[model samples]
Target: EEEEEEEEEEEEEEEEEEEEEEEEEEEEEEEEEEEEEEEEEEEEEEEEEGEEEEEEEEEEEEEEEEEEEEECLEYINFCYKLVISVCCERSVVVVPHKDTSGVTRHVMRGEKCWCCASQRHFRCHTTCHARSLQP
Candidate 1:
């Protein structure tokens, strides 16, 4: 009977050691899973931020294109009007004027000559001098 009691005690000790090892393995697995979940969340947030930045860049480009288109249209309209006036023999003159109020960059003055009517932004003094000189 003494020998039997000793064997039983030894078996109980072995079982307790195996249970402790299994508990340790389970704890390690839980920690690994938590780490993986946190990493995934971080990756998702980074992707979302990248997408937002791209969208903003695209919007800015589109707005710039729109502004360019409007400016081109305005320039075209001015050119068309100039052509009509020239064809009708209506003289147009462009004279440089200082902006007293910081508003207009240049102001027109006097009736435009035939040469000025044909040329765009024609300087009257230079062209007049060239044309009027004895050839």
Candidate 2:
């Protein structure tokens, strides 16, 4: 009977140790799962930030393109206008543009003979030191 009691006690102790080990393993698994969840969340946040930056860059590019389009349109308008310049004695010609209530639509530098010899800004190439151009 004594031997049986000793064997039973040993068996009980072994079972308790096994239970403790199982509990430790479960706790370790829980910790690993939490760490994985945290890492996933961090990755997701990084992706979102990257996406936002890309969107902002795209918007800026679009704005620049719109500004470029406006400039091109202005150039096209200048090309289609009927411009005439008159100058005398190798002088620069200052031609007339839209006269908005005596406000003088086109403003430029150099003497206002403004015919031939006008600067590139004036966009005129006709010179009349000899005779007037036939438009």
Candidate 3:
């Protein structure tokens, strides 16, 4: 009877050890799952931040384009006024003349002249004269 009791006690101890090991494995698995979840959440937040930054950059680019368009319209109006003043009121000759400076002073046949010359008045005068001849 004593021997049987000793065997039973040994078996109980073995079972307890197995149960403890299983609990430890379950805890480890839970910890790993929690860590994976945290990592995923961090990645999602980063993606959202990147998207917001991209949106802001796009908005800024759009605003810059609008400002450039407005400036272009204003320049066109100024050029139109110059054409009217020199062609109609001044009645200057619509010919290209090169002055002391090497820069050519007239609009090309098919090309637009930005009036890039050292002398502003002469440049506007020639550009306006050329513009008058256009249909």
Candidate 4:
């Protein structure tokens, strides 16, 4: 009977050890899950920051294009007299002095004049008039 009690005690110890091991495994799995969630949150934040940066870059590009268009109108002399033909039928009057006034206000915020124009259009009014003669 004592021998049997010893064997039963040994088996109980083994079962206890197995239960402890299972609990340790469960704790480790919980820790791993927490770590994975943290990593995913970090990644999502990074992606959000990246998207914001891209949006800022796109806004900058759009502002630059708007600046270029405004400068084009500024440098062109007699811009008020310039009549732009839309598809060779209707004509749109380009009053640079009035239409470009708002754009100039924005450019003036950076204290820059309308000096940055396309290199191809070197001459002010003469170049456009010359181009109009071409077929």
In terms of lDDT, the best-performing candidate is 3
For model 3, what is the alpha-carbon lDDT of residue 128?
46
Q: Candidate 2, which segments miss by more than 4 Å at Cα? A: 75-135
Give the per-residue lDDT of model 2 (tens digit) for 32-53: 9999999999999999999999
Q: Candidate 4 regions off by >4 Å?
A: 77-127, 130-135
- Which scores higher on TM-score, 2 or 3? 3
Q: What is the TM-score of each candidate against the true structure?
A: 0.57, 0.56, 0.64, 0.58
Candidate 4 residue-wise lDDT at 5: 100
Per-residue CA lDDT of model 3 for 1-135, tens digit only, reads: 999999999999999999999999999999999999999999999999999999999999999999987865665565566555555554542344333353536543323434343334443444444443321
Clashing pairs in 3: none
Stretches > 4 Å off in candidate 3: 91-135
User: For each candidate, what is the lDDT?
Assistant: 0.58, 0.58, 0.63, 0.54
Q: Give the TM-score of candidate 4.
A: 0.58
lDDT of 2 at 91: 39
> Would you list the clashing residue pairs of candidate 4?
none
The top-ranked prediction according to TM-score is 3
lDDT of 3 at 114: 46
Error (Å) of candidate 2 at residue 87 is 10
lDDT of 1 by residue, 19-71 (tens): 99999999999999999999999999999999999999999999999998786
lDDT of 2 at 62: 100
Ranking according to TM-score, highest score first? 3, 4, 1, 2
